[model samples]
Target: MSEIALEARNLYKVFGRNPAQAVKRLKAGETRDDVLDVGTAAVIDASFAVQRGEIFVIMGLSGSGKSTIIRMLNGLHDITDGEVTIGGDPITGIPRGRLREIRRDRVSMVFQHFALLPHRTVADNVAYPLELRGVAKADRRARAEEILAMVGLAGWGDKLPSELSGGMQQRVGIARALAADTDILLMDEAFSALDPLIRREMQEQLVELQAKLQKTIVFITHDLNEAMFLGDRIAVMRDGRIVQIGTPEDILTDPANDYVEQFVQDVDRARVLTAGNVMERPRPYVPDTGGPRAALRQMKDAYSSAAYVTDRDRKLMGIVTDRDAVKLVRKGENSLRSILKPVPQSVSQDETLMNLFVPAVESPLPLAVTDEHDRLVGVIPRVTLLAALGPGPNATEEITLPMPPLPHAEIDAALGGAESAHEASANEVPTIKAPANEGEVR
Candidate 1:
């Protein structure tokens, strides 16, 4: 596990002049409403760790105390009770001066509004954080220019915030926070002000940046879809408390409570589901040198008619089918290379299921799930892929009739004879139809 970059230990924040009395009541098992009877209880016993370089999202509807929790993390909101630590230093009740130093050096926040300076040039706005720390003007300017380029605002830095679009202004806000060179980012609805299309664009950019920058981000959002897309793990808040914390798949497939279940019931599974979710442990394969006889025997044992062929390093070479194996054995061929046909379809583990539709439909072979090195990891059979998208308002329930059975009879038995005659043709492992001219899928 990654080292904890930020931790909230029983963190509590009550928002009122007599907050201490409310905290005491809350500690003694009085509810948030009861605490509110005395004074506002904005957060109650919220605790979670933000691991280094992970996007930890806190999400809930309005008034869920998510924003309050983030404020307490950066010491912007006074903690009523419990502790918060940043980079291993206890932050609750720290001296104001020390708290300021931690906020300056270890953490930065991006607010919902762009918060850009209307009159300042983008470069100046981005450099403002560095300027506060007494960085040399030239050094800060250079840093600002570099970060602007990273955010895709390269030559436009000389323009003022008023001259930029909403998305661009948000980028400036992000650039300013990044200029502080902090390890933690507390972004509270930072992209909420943008147009829907632009908000999505900003989200994609943040995802891309996270791939390169690896900063520890605490993203607060009310949109469940946004939370599912951006968060490595999510904390769902309600009534000043966290109700669930889990990965997107975990939250979707196994909701912790009815509230969470209702919250995610409408989520687009295809958008959130990846090839990794549907892929099965690939059946055993043979090296290209494994003769036709051995290949045939293995296929029979596995009740499969086709087998993947790979090199010594497990790099995919091609696929060999029962028909080809039979012909090769008849011809007394020692190696399976002559009969091997190039893999018809493949997907990276992270490819969203939405992107796999065309390939899944067009290919006869199971979709190959390959790693970055083009080495096969597992396979997503058409049956399994269809099953994942089975009967739902958002899914094509009609897919049941067209889905071919899995390659093995054992699987057919397990599936209660969902296997059909159409699937038997999989024995030939139909080759991907190429343009009459080009030879490869790429």
Candidate 2:
């Protein structure tokens, strides 16, 4: 077994008039007129390699060739040019029987629909693939039961697919794929057909399964949100070309172009950009008894625009700006301490950058992040955040912070939860807003 699970080189898939003409043109040079005159290329010179135990996602709008490239991966659709290597062997030009050997032995695909055997029980549907591959009935059934429990469907093995809800049936389909025990699993928009809440649940379930199984997966989707949530590394496709491929943190904070930026702008960055990504440079020294005035100078020296203030222990205290320091000095105040503003708010290190508004408005001047100990460990100034998440001036939305961790009772008051039970802070694990159009948004 090679360390590399899959590799593709300069793959192209074209359709329409003079398909040969397009293939010939690819050999010489790509011409827009020839492609348009013939047919648009589905995947134009697309290439990448997936190492073992990697979850590689390809996301694009509808008709962006995510599905097409996936089909090519499974040999369901032939590529016009280029080679696809699986397990260190090029399977792109393999014969039908050889391809079947690879599909049955090394790869299995799970479609958006459950594609279950409607007439058979869940156990039978899951075991059918094994049966086709010549596995004995007893072994197939035993494997099916084991996979059933793996996906949380242990006792319902005898139930028909129709008896289960869409999400449950999808779980059955996933269990079936797992029963194959292949080197790679290909998922084609596997969550699209479900309700938003169900889809989100399924996405989380996929993550949990991947953690345990560690199977190399190629997941296809047109939803950027899903790509961000599920992929270990993502490939953003447009008009059949991969625009960018990287970790979700990079895609959210440093998109490649305007198209990528537009998709990121609407996303709640606080929820996507984690605290760890933006904590690049820490201030060199913590201010002594000089108050925030000395701290403001340090802040200005670090970035000249907006800097942070921390306590003697280098824990975030508040922000001291030159303007604030000057005001305190003009008032004949002996110390710049009174001029310092508390952090707008505090946020968990795991939160996405889009959800940053929650803490920004809550904090005073410099944004502080600390563990439950009430010690300031990190700070995010407004300037840094704007440069990270690009959008309209919505970055100005701020929330003030306190010295230490606030109690639940205080948090309830801050959220106005006691005044009206309708609106409260979002749960850390995410509360699924029932299926879309259920009644109201969560």
Candidate 3:
């Protein structure tokens, strides 16, 4: 199957009698303002593709046409120009019956309001779509029960919408969409109506559910933070037009224009940047050659006091310091095993920088970055981490440092002080600060 699950091309939505003419004007290099006399352009020449199992968010403030673009995807709003396709099948200009079938079997939508039927049981509300398709009551009811459990409302199937809390009610809304068993999901402000705490919880729940379900989602929102937290890629819309589309880090570090720059100026960079974004190629690693002399030479070549020890397959074994390597050499040790020290800390490639502050500070050497199989992929030096945290146009720029050596005494003292401070306030989060001296190893 192709990777693209949904796509929109040159899409335009106009709300007036002469929408077709307005689109012509737009196509003729005339601005949206030029076509204002003909019709109101809701979405203008918006184009993007949503990969399978990806969360593609459309974000903009009110009247930016984000909502209109989403409606066009599933044929809720007629396209004034361009096309929309789901799973390689065009839905635009299709017969209403065929579109209905597509919506029933391949796409489902969840709205901002719970939209549950007030008089029906939660299970019935969820099973309504299946019921419309003439599914046997017993089968649809069972399916509803199963989906309810997946959304964390297992035993609440018997309760009415009126009897449930607002958050729980929204879960039913999601349950209903999932019960449809569609590969594509369109969520329009789905969590915007909940309380602040409840909204955050729902956002987290959606991410967890997406992991298990792997549904291709088109999430519409006005909140930049939500977009950063949830979207695999985001399309930023302005008045009736898409201005930029990129990953959260791309949007943050390289805004396309002043409008986008202003939008991301207040975003918390720590949460958006992951280890993979800032990590550099791992260097000066000894390939478990079983020789302390080899380890020392590698350290010296990299201008460092320490180096990682990895097996032939690049699976990280441990680290070796120059001092330890020298001791092993003097003691006539042939193997690096005696001198190997367990890496002080390691982080997965996807770990956010916010969670790495303490680990980066505690490590004597650059923090190891590993993949699922524990193979060393890269390293995150303290200097690089500090650079990423600093404010400037180059805040997110990658920095490469020659692995400079730190004296064993200084390394021990820094680690000891960090560990002590960490133990003193286990509940408080540590903040990032620049070192007093640029030459000092972070």
Q: Specify the highest-lDDT model's number.
A: 3
Q: Write the per-residue lDDT of candidate 3 for residues 25-48, one digit (tens) a residue.
A: 898888878888989999999999
What lDDT does the true structure give each of the candidates?
A: 0.81, 0.72, 0.84
lDDT of 2 by residue, 375-401 (tens): 544555555566556545754553232
Give the alpha carbon lDDT tens digit for every residue of 197-253 in model 1.
999999999999999999999999999999999999999999999999999988888
TM-score of each: 0.85, 0.70, 0.86
TM-score of 1: 0.85
Residue pair clashes in candidate 3? none
| Candidate 1: segments with Cα more than 4 A from true spot | 284-290, 297-305, 393-442
RMSD of each: 7.9, 12.8, 9.2
- Candidate with more favorable, higher lDDT: 2 or 3: 3
Selected candidate, larger TM-score, 2 vs 3: 3
